[model samples]
Target: MADWGAIGAVKSAVNIPVIANGDIIDAPSASRALELSGADGVMIGRGAQGQPWVLAQIAAELAGQVYRGPQGHALADVILKHYEDVIRFYGPDLGVRNARKHLTWYLERLEGGMELRNLIIRERDASVVLKRLTEGLKNCGPIIEVAA
Candidate 1:
């Protein structure tokens, strides 16, 4: 559990803005942190690892808006774009290696995704990994369905 009390104490004492961070995964948690800590905002860390859209979701929920999140082809495009950008930033070899963990997180919740995840982490070729990721996302289920 997060030390929300500690955050509250800090918020009361500190002159600068306090941002509560730690285990603030979803809207409810974010709301709770803010309510208890008296902070300006909450900071999401690992929760946003693969599903970066979670930020939007949390925000929408806080504002009483509906956030369905990306699905199907759109979600696939987002994942692929992220992978490609990682590859570009780090170069083929380093990029592929660094992206393995992120890809794993992205597919962790997929139904029957273990095999694809295994292949993705072990495979060295960026093209092969991208192709496999695309196919797996398409054939399995909705992006949100597979989210861990």
Candidate 2:
């Protein structure tokens, strides 16, 4: 969790808009951070690692708008699209290496994904990685495991 007290102090001192960061993962946490820090907004780092739509989801929740996160095939499509974009921007060689971290993050919460994660992270070929990712996403069910 963020030191919202310190953030509040900063907010009290500054004239510009304050954006609270750290541990603001979900909508509830984001709301709490804003309330505790008295900030205009919150910034998320690790929280938005693989699930990039999280910030927008938080925003919608804050605004009392209907927000639905991607699931199933939709979520798979998003992950694949992100992968392809990274490859396009960085080229296959660097992109595969760079995207491993993001792919790992994406698979962190998935069920039956450990094997896929291992394969995806180790494989250098973008096409092979993509195929594995698609298959993994399709096969793996939603089963988030809490880290100890």
Candidate 3:
């Protein structure tokens, strides 16, 4: 939504590539948005927040290609690293707070995530959050939670 205007306007004004950013969550949406905005390419932002493979998905579909999602353990590691990055970016207090939401999301992708999410929210700081998240991983046994 945020980049629609710029994308549309740029597409209209120049022959260069006009990449639309924001709110492109899937292949249909990506194609529809480009069609609507008359843009050359789409640049997704938050839509790929937790699902990094979304970019490849869109790219593949739009480019008449196929894209497979990340592997299980590989995806888990990506998610865990994402939490660590968030903690590093936002610091322990805000980071831990932010990680809470992300952890919930990560948990949902697994089997029994609600309990783990509930347990994680109780953590007060980054270290505790990380610990709880790790514990959740170990104790909950393969729960992929996605925060709402």
Clashes of each: 1, 0, 14
List runs of model 3 lying over 4 Å from the truth: 1-10, 14-17, 138-148
- Model with the higher TM-score, candidate 2 or 3: 2
Looking at model 3, residue 73 earns an lDDT score of: 67
Superposition TM-score, candidate 2 onto the true structure: 0.89
Error of 2 at 23 (Å): 1.1
**lDDT by residue (tens digit), candidate 3, 30-105:** 8888877888777877677557778898889888999877655666677778889998999877888877767755
Off by over 4 Å in 1: 144-148
For candidate 1, lDDT tens digit of each residue in 62-81? 99998977877888798889
Q: Residue by residue across 74-123, what tens digits does model 2's lDDT show?
A: 88898899999999999999999999998888887677767789867889
Q: What is the lDDT of candidate 1?
A: 0.85
Q: TM-score of each candidate?
A: 0.91, 0.89, 0.73
- Of 1 and 3, the candidate ranking higher by lDDT: 1
Give residue 30's error in model 3 in angstroms.
0.8
